[model samples]
Target: MAQSGRTNSVSISHRSTLFVIPKWYNSATFPKDIMRDNISRREGLLMHNKMLFVRPDKPITSVKNNSIRYSGWTYVGSANLSESAWGRLVLDRATTKPKLNCRNWECGVVIPIRHNDEEKSSYIPSTRGITTSVAESGGGNTSAGSDDGSRVASVFEPTVPVPMKVPAQRYHGRDRPFFYMED
Candidate 1:
């Protein structure tokens, strides 16, 4: 879900929720103003009376170098949320694992979901440079149109990388780090 476009506005509805993984790409396609407008409109206004989740702290790095829209249990892999990629998942009745019938090569990481991990799932990074107020206030970009009307264009705001503090020991036992989300 690139922040500069209106594609996501279609997928949201009363019965469903949309969680947008954030991005830091500076291309014109993902402008900061549009991103702010989106956060304000979809998240701030509490669209659907509170369903959309847009947390810029959770930056998603994709193989295509873009942000992706994620929902619950369904994993769309590296593919877009299109029919071909999402329509083929079948549950293995015995093992309870999801099986996919793919039309092309794709990649995804599957992690077992635990319903009780609310603390970790809801921990929004407050120290990160960007905040909900920043996104809602149109932090540093010029927005040309109203939220009800089509956005003419948006300017990209360059972001400085925040350094991370090292812990005494690794949190995850594995060599690589992983992120987990719950609904």
Candidate 2:
């Protein structure tokens, strides 16, 4: 979910959490008011631009007494969080109707992390730059067990090394996020 406003003005409910991941630059020379606001309000973290990983602590289960549950999800692509990239609903001037107006060509894939009913384990979807595991002792080692001794496994092995720092960094007071048109 995205919003265009100050961080303090937005109120997130207890049932939902928000994560804001913005682009990172090497020189760290641009003005990053957005990142600074997010950090001041404790609303966001810095992550890689090429990849996104979302692992919920608790799985979302079905409400109809079914065994199905969703562990997590991942999004990888070229779409940035913008109206032109994701499209915006606008009223058509000629037709008096509402339509989605997108100015840019963007594409992305959202892969859902599924819970394996047959194996009774959580299947974490692996990506190019993220290390995902559910180890037995909660250590960094890759294993096929959860902290509670339940079986857990990766659906696919991570093919590439992580490009950025693990456990994404928070913006300090002096830190700044890069802007493309900054002069």
Question: Best-fitting candidate, measured by lDDT?
Answer: 2
Residue 126 in model 2: lDDT: 34
How well is each residue in 66-179 modelled by candidate 2, as lDDT tens digits? 677755556668976556577899899999999998778877877766654653444443322233321121223333332321222232114222333222233454433333
Tell me the tens digit of each residue's lDDT in model 1 across 36-138: 3222233323222211112333333444634442111212136543446446788988889998766765566442122223333443343333323223333
Off by over 4 Å in 1: 1-78, 93-96, 106-183
By TM-score, who's the top model here? 2
- Report the backbone clash tally of model 1: 1
C-alpha lDDT of all candidate models, in order: 0.30, 0.41
Instruction: Determine which window of 10 residues in candidate 1 has minimal summed lDDT.
Output: 160-169
* Candidate 1: residue 11 lDDT (0-100): 39
Candidate 2 has which clashing residue pairs, if any? none
Question: What C-alpha root-mean-square deviation, in Å, does candidate 1 show against the real structure?
Answer: 19.8
What's the count of clashing pairs in each model shown? Answer: 1, 0
